[model samples]
Target: MPSSAAHLLSNHYNETRNEYYRQLDTASRNGGDILPFINYAVQGFVDQIRNQIKHIRTEQLRIVWINYVHSRFKTLSSRKDRRRRDLLLHISEFGLLHKNIIGVMALKIYAGKTVTTLKRDIGYLRSEELIEETLTGYFPNLKALTAFLPVQRRVVE
Candidate 1:
């Protein structure tokens, strides 16, 4: 597996772990029952983590694609701009991890990139794209990089 894939899997695992912690924190603050927390620790947490592990490969490919696109912006000079790019990557990775059709939509409503912007970034990258055909086996649509872009969001306003 590529290092990019591993990083994505790690990020997924950490997200799951952080969510679990958040649940515990919320419960503690609310003075909720301890029984459910114990059950979550013993069964829910383990089962969720196991399920995530089962689909690690799919998650890896998703992140690898994002990483490939992100690599295009490696020369960004402004810290603020780089942070925005990093946040975009993080949201994209999270949406991919959810494995849902509306994942990117959810991200957009929560302050993620518009699909057009993402596609534009991809187009920008394509002008100087360096990925070779051999990478396709590892990435579902590696030969056509834009195929990995998230679905475009329609502004309601």
Candidate 2:
């Protein structure tokens, strides 16, 4: 898809998603009175979403999906655990193993810590299978990390 069309589609999708959530909140705030009609209303929103998705090509859809994943990772990295979040941010952006990064220098400076301290965190992440240490450097298991994150699943209609 053309850039203009993709932008337009994204705008439209955001608007529709916001409107759907607003309506859902309004309906649910009525003290359970609107329970019976919630599914019907949601189905309408789902249909609208389906219509929007149906026109996009596979490559465009893949781009949108990746953007969604990246956005989710950004949100996940904003957690209160500063060290872990910083590590996650670094890995997601630079891709430790996959990108053929050198030693701990990249994340070491980012965390403002010495190699020893960073190495501990790296070891922990490796134990958790979020990263792997090789002769080259530490690399991230992006697919595994993404799957492990508690991101909300999309509701398909």
Tens-place lDDT per residue, model 1, 8-96, is 54454466788667767878987886776566555554454456665774676666778765775677757544644553465444432
Q: Flag regions of model 2 displaced more than 4 Å.
A: 1-80, 97-112, 145-157
- Candidate 1 lDDT (Cα, 0 to 1): 0.51
Give candidates' CA RMSD values in order. Answer: 16.5, 15.8
Tell me the TM-score of each prediction against the true structure: 0.27, 0.35
Model 1, runs deviating above 4 Å: 1-57, 96-157
* Model 1 pairs whose backbones collide: none
Cα deviation at 148, candidate 2, in Å, is: 10
Assess the local accuracy of residue 81 in candidate 2 as a C-alpha lDDT between 0 and 100.
Answer: 40
